[model samples]
Target chain A: MTAPSRHALVPFVSVDNMMKLVLHIGVERMMTELAAEIEADFLRWPLFDKTPRVASHSEVGVIELMPTSDGETYGFKYVNGHPSNMKKGLQTVTAFGLLADVATGYPLMLSEMTLLTALRTAATSAMAAKWLAPKGTRVMAMIGNGAQAEFQALAFKAVCGIAEVRLYDIDPAATAKCARNLAGRGLNVVSCNSAEQAMEGAQIVTTCTADKQYATILTDNMVGSGVHINAVGGDCPGKTELHRDILLRSGIFVEYPPQTRIEGEIQQLEADHPVTELWQVIAGQAEGRSDARQITLFDSVGFAIEDFSALRYVHSRLKDSGLYQNLDMIADPDDPRDLFGMLLRAGAAQAA
Target chain B: MTAPSRHALVPFVSVDNMMKLVLHIGVERMMTELAAEIEADFLRWPLFDKTPRVASHSEVGVIELMPTSDGETYGFKYVNGHPSNMKKGLQTVTAFGLLADVATGYPLMLSEMTLLTALRTAATSAMAAKWLAPKGTRVMAMIGNGAQAEFQALAFKAVCGIAEVRLYDIDPAATAKCARNLAGRGLNVVSCNSAEQAMEGAQIVTTCTADKQYATILTDNMVGSGVHINAVGGDCPGKTELHRDILLRSGIFVEYPPQTRIEGEIQQLEADHPVTELWQVIAGQAEGRSDARQITLFDSVGFAIEDFSALRYVHSRLKDSGLYQNLDMIADPDDPRDLFGMLLRAGAAQAA
Candidate 1:
């Protein structure tokens, strides 16, 4: 009997390998490349098959499956958000994703997305900020300095040319951790005691707290004109960060309106509230940062296409990097229709 | 840094390991046990979160993600069907699946499900037949003798009281392959040239052809009264097996009605076609095989919960069986909020 061919093997990047890959590429350069990949996808957004994530919400948190295809390749991410997990020494969010060939429906790669999600989220935020933030913006504020804070700060510096980042969080240890992690990251990092202090001299304010309730992390009084607000924490139906008044004052931009309406800060507004699709702006079909004093807010609810781009980028990177292992994942018989015969032969091989 | 806790490691069953597992457990006994697990889940169908399988369709075929939860355990299957793949010497259907803790959203097991899906599909069919087929069903006619034919025959012998299987395929080579595989499987196996020839004195007929279009593998006159027809193929939109006249005559039962309307044999019928939910019939909430003259049809599209049960059953079986390897699939930091620190430490450890 012919042995299972190379078709049965799928390359997998585990958490250890993912971290190795990130360190090998250098996080800042990875973020910049991810930003470019995301931008390229956004430019060709019309070619993508988009759908709102299918989520299973429980009392603790939610698990979602986000899938998309760009006609040639298909990708999906399995992600979870359980804010209470942090108290138990577990990440509030965890993820893994897969990329597949559209022609044969074969999985190309599977990778842990906990780190990649952070990179993509920050890259997406920086991409939006590049389009919507005021001209000559150099200072950014990172509120709720948790696991994503350093990634956000580095991504902004790498993608949007931000020179300094001011960090603030409700917990002092989180702020200290963020400050220490960003010590040598090529950016001027400042730790602030209050959210208002973090926003001082900042042209961009990013909120990424791990709160599961409808608490206002960003209010109308705090957001000034011409500053872009990247609201990242509020990504569920009952959980939001920005106030309704802040949403009314800002011209909101979203990855997908159908999803943002149900999960983003705009969930506080009317269902028909006018919001620009970010892809249109990136594709040059709509205006971005129209005037000097325009309050442009990207109410970012993560989308499937961004994950697709990340997976595609990682799959392309596998040729040069040996940080993956081949998994005996697919069952391939010598003759495709003789699956039962293959099983029998496998048993006999074990006996032999 | 502290070592990652056990929760961070997910058990992964590879193809080689799964084949060993099936052989160790004994195939017929495993299928019969799987039928019981499926029956138990079906009995509590209302508790599950059910949705139509999310599919991404290309020109050649389709890839689907099927997810369902019983509020405590969440499971999903990633499966692809490409008829063109067989011509290139690949299985027409290949799959993998995951079972996760709903409370924490951490995957407990990642398994190669191509073999498992075949097991579950055959098991589920035998389960449905056990509830809906006429009394004293000792013989079954399996048309389309391809990959699933032997599995269906064995499952029926183990779950129901079937003692013989008559097989027929459009391609004589496929029938010969199936007959060869099932030669010593403790059942009377017959190979025939035509579907009508195989159906002689058969009480059940199972159609499982691999076609992407609406092809009639089973016509009206070929089906007799009181025979249970298990239609396994034609599971996607614009694909079906039995002719429309047979569907009109048979008392149809389906897994999920909304999904069936788009992808089952009843797709040939009206949108509002009156059909019994198979779970309700199994739970004694509805009737199955009301009379001897009635033709019963299980228009199976394969639901998410059945895969959930299959995964759950597999997980349960993995406890004493050391048939899996731990994958470092989740990133667990000493401090959950310091993911950057974890990556930096990983890099340092590699360098050291």
Candidate 2:
């Protein structure tokens, strides 16, 4: 009745504000923090209501709604992956997310999630590598140096203390762009001509190509023993990056089995292909790297809980950063039963 | 490489702007137009990708994501229902929605849907009543005079030429508030002390009480022959308004049977009980109001497509009304593969 109340105002983090926030707390430091946040959520995986993402797939792309709730707070992300979008100078994956209170069923925050998704995806990869990678891993072979390449490179340096990264892509310009961006970020950036060349001395190899087909970006011979394979880009049905033979030789670990079996690299294997749950490994309930010669694969298709963690992290940062704008998203009338009266008063105010 | 492009900016309709837009068009006229739009979408129901709403329920309330795509465009609404919210001076229901281009998977618009939802629910009820109500229906008996009551009253007046509305609520203050709001709206408003008194000579009866448990708002004896019942508030599992005998007497019509069977008033009836699809009736694929003596009921649980229609209607009106603000919601890089470079450039611009 007296305009919208404070409860009606949801904090919104725009793309501009998100970028400012990333810069305010340097990208590597933020990813390190995001990694810790994601790991903490992983520790309490059983408490979350993990709903498989509802996807609306068209011929060109897919739009998805991924939702999860941790009893007290609920969160969801609206994301789209359109490989064809790149040709039109649009991000292949663009996203936004919201967090709401479970008790009142009111939204708490709305944030642009494209950059945050990138950050969280990278943070998740580094966190998994922390559990599954060989000890003293120093170099990472980054194949398909697209938007996610630099983030993965930086996260490894921040979370796992990796000192160098070797980059390669089908598109050399992408590799060159990644190398240029990673120039002064303290990592030894090497632009390689071939995937094999990039993987020469690396202990971790990440494949993150953006095509929607089952194209093999890595083969069995290219991946050696003791290498942790962070397969980052095979995230939909019929879309995979590593050869089936490589998955056969590795100890596969995933965020969620039901989803990863259909969308991750394990889609190439049978339904019961025996992939370890990464959360169990992080919580010390299961073995990570059983030996130095074991090839541990973190089949990264992303999950709702990781996004929920990222949103929660951003919400926690908002009060200190003051980087969000108040959005009049919810309608709060003075008398909850008099919504129409509120509208009538609004009309009068406009007329005045 | 550069700043966000025009495509990155999505048009956002806040609650205040939504009120201004509604007032600009006038509530009755907007509901009339919205009814037509919803009817049009109902006619082409087969073209849509109908995904059941994903709901997260807590002890106190429930949050839901309802999504649908019409091949070319996709829309989703985030809504929450907390019956206990009113006791804390909060709305019992609140919502927001987004529309995206299916081809590129890019969001085109974001709008506060709390007000729009009330308008669409009313419009849908009136649209259904137009086909199922007795011919030349002139009076509507609104049983629950809460937030949704006034909208329902006005929609019936605008769409079905309802000349009078008899309003009644468990609490008299709600009825008083509703009566005051409808005073100068060109319809004869009557405040009734009981449910039976509200239905004195009305041909259309609308029940829209907000409670989480089953309650008998109307019985079979209270509903006379040829009355069209608009059941609005019984929209979740275990929540219903009409007596079981009343449902047995009425020819029930619904939105989506799979969903309505679980959430609508039909939840009180047998799972295999006969209920007509309202879209089929709108499309002439099924009969409506077969005979004057046969009672008709619209078990209105609401649907994603109805919300889709409302969003598309609002998007169409935005240009002429100019009541929206641009939100930097999507991330658009000069080169889609150079997202890192864009962030780097944003940092450089910030430093400059």
Candidate 2's docking class is medium
Candidate 1 residue lDDT tens string, B1-352: 2366676799999998888899999999999999999999999999999889999999999999999999999999999999999999998999999998888888999999999999999999999999889999899999998888888999999999899899999999999999898888889998887899999999999999988898999889999999999999847888889899998999999999999999898888889879999999988899899998899999998999989998998899787889898888898888989999998888778788
TM-scores, each model vs. reference: 0.98, 0.99
TM-score of chain B of each: 0.98, 0.98
**Which candidate leads the pack in DockQ?**
2
Q: Least accurate stretch of 10 residues (summed lDDT) in model 2 chain B?
A: B1-10
True contacts kept of 1: 0.82
Task: Identify the candidate with maximal TM-score.
Answer: 2
Q: Candidate 1: TM-score? A: 0.98
Weakest ten-residue segment in model 2 chain A by summed lDDT: A1-10
**Collision count for each candidate, in order:** 0, 1
lDDT of 2 by residue, B97-117 (tens): 999999898999999999999
- CA error at residue B298 for candidate 2, angstroms: 0.3
